[model samples]
Target: MSATALATWTVVALLGVMTPGIDTVLVLRHTIVGGGRSGLAAVGGIAAGCLVWAVASLAGLAALLAASTLAYDIVRIAGAVYLVWLGLSAIWKTLPRHRTEGGGVDALDAPGVSARVALRAGFFTNLLNPKVGVFYISLLPQFLPVGPAATAWGIVLVAIHLGVTFLWYPALIALAARARGVLLRGRVRAWMERVTAVVLIGVGVRLATTP
Candidate 1:
């Protein structure tokens, strides 16, 4: 691909990364509660999901989801349910009632789960969403340079997408980490959790309602 084409693809991929959605909310929530490492794990999961879609798109499997309404609906509904469940779980845990002792930096800084578990949370969250597969199927082809090495070109494009994630997700993690002192406060953490829950639920509703 020419420099211009690469630049264009970068701009588009960055925009997609910066879009605030369930993934962002999840990362932000985890970052606030479990610090930067947890958030980064989620980003890894999101990246892994994108890569999986990239492979599927290359294999022509993603096109099947676009053509088969039943397959699309099944995946969409599952994603919606998973998103809502995550949102509700966040809301439930952050309720003011669960005021455990030592409600300070130590508790707030602790990982909610193991790193592997956190990673899995991220992997499943993205893997289960068919929109991502469909998105790659549609968007990647537009950026592919006409050549015998089109598959190689496609991988490069996906790498650009992953590059955007690396850039955007870490900055977010750092920002959340910087605000760790304030986020450690119970009330602030509660409100943050509420905001995350709302975002997740809103995304789920939009996903479920959208065609």
Candidate 2:
């Protein structure tokens, strides 16, 4: 691809990354609960998911989701169920019995789950969303250069998307980390988690119900 095309795609990808979505809420929730390491792990998983979609798109796999309604609905429903489960879990953690003595930072530790949970949440959240596969299959070809090198250039475009994602998400993690003291306070953490959970559930429902 030419420099201008690459730069244009970079800007488009950056815009998409900067737009708040499920990925944003997941990163924020993990950062508030498990700190920067957890948030970074989530970021890594999301990037991995994107890479998977990119590779699948290049292999003509993502087109299957776009072309087949059955495939699309199955993934959509699965993604919805996963999001609802995560939301319910978050709500469960905030219950009275689950609360630590004074609802301290220790209470917000996410109890039994490790940073890997966040990583998996990030990965599966991105992976099960049929829209992502469709997005790649539809948009990627537009920027792909003509000829045999097109496949190689497609990977480059995806790299640009991933690169933008890395920059944007880590900066968000850092910002959340700096506010850790206030965010991890008992009530604040609980409320933030609750809000995040609700948003996740809402988004999930919307995703499921949308045609």
Candidate 3:
């Protein structure tokens, strides 16, 4: 790809990463509950998920998912169910029984969103979302360079997307960490979880309903 095209693709990818979505919320949720380490683990998982999609796109697996309605529906339903479950679980943790047992601590304690769990949450959340694969298969082709080297260029473009995500999410984690004093408070954390949970559920429903 030309420098101009590369630059444009980079900008687009950065914007995509920066756009607030389930991925962003998951990172923030994990960070709020489990601190920077857990947040980073989530980020790592999300990055792995993206890498999987990139590889799938290059291998035409993503295209297969996009082309086959049955495959797409299966992944979409699974993603929706996962998001709803996460949301419901978050809400469950905010209940009276869970809170009275402890106060200041967040989900890291309630149901236990340990680093490993966060990592798995991040990975599966992205992996199950068929739209992600569709996005990759559709978007990557536009930026790929022509000829036999195109496959390699696709990887480079994906790397660029992942690079942008790494930069953005870490900054997000830092920003949340800075506000830890207020955010970590029991009431505040509970409310934040509730809101995030609602959002997750709503996104899940939207995903399920949308074509």
Candidate 4:
């Protein structure tokens, strides 16, 4: 690909990475609950998802998936359900629970979720969203140089997207970490989780309803 094409693609991909969405929320929440390590774990999960979509897009698998109405509906429904489940779970965990024993510690402050779980959360969340694959299918083609090596150019573009993500995520982690003092506190954390839950559910509903 020409340098001009690459630079344009890089700018577009970087903008997508910086956009606020479920991915950003997941990173922020994990960081708030489990610190920088947990945040990076989630970032890794998202990167895995991006790489998978990138490969799938280059292989025409993403196009095939997008072309099939039944397949798209199946994946879309699954994604919607998963998002709703995540939102409901977050809200349920926020509700007051009685202690089985006297002097039980308050578990509201730190969510106590493990890094692996956070990693899985990030992976499945993005993997289920066919929108990512659809996006790659549409976006990568525009940057391909006219040649038999179209797939090669696709890979290059995917790499650019991943590179932009890598650059953006650490900054996101740092920002989330810097706000740890106020955001991770008991009542504040609870409220934040509540808001996140609502947003997740809303996004799911919108996805399910949109054509």
Estimate the Cα RMSD of every predicted model relative to the unseen true structure: 2.3, 1.6, 1.8, 2.2
lDDT of 4 at 95: 68
Model 2 lowest lDDT segment of ten: 104-113
Q: Clashing residue pairs, candidate 4? A: none
Per-residue lDDT, model 2, residue 166, is: 92
Compared with the true structure, all predictions reach lDDT values of 0.80, 0.87, 0.87, 0.82
**What order do candidates take by lDDT, descending?**
3, 2, 4, 1
Give the residue spans of candidate 2 off by over 4 A.
Answer: 101-106
Instruction: Using TM-score, give the best candidate's number.
Output: 2
Quote the lDDT for 76 in model 2.
96
Report clash pairs, candidate 3: none
**TM-scores, all models, native as reference:** 0.90, 0.95, 0.94, 0.92
Residue-level error in angstroms, candidate 2, position 41: 0.4
Tens digits of per-residue lDDT, candidate 1, 1-211, equal 7899889989999889999876787787777787787889888988998899899998889999999999998888888888888778777776545545566423432334355656776887788798898889998888887777889988888888998999999999899889877876767777777787788788778778886
Query: Candidate 4 — worst ten consecutive residues by lDDT sum?
Result: 98-107
Which candidate, 3 or 4, would have the higher TM-score against the true structure?
3
Could you tell me the C-alpha RMSD of candidate 3 in Å? 1.8
Clashes of each: 0, 0, 0, 0
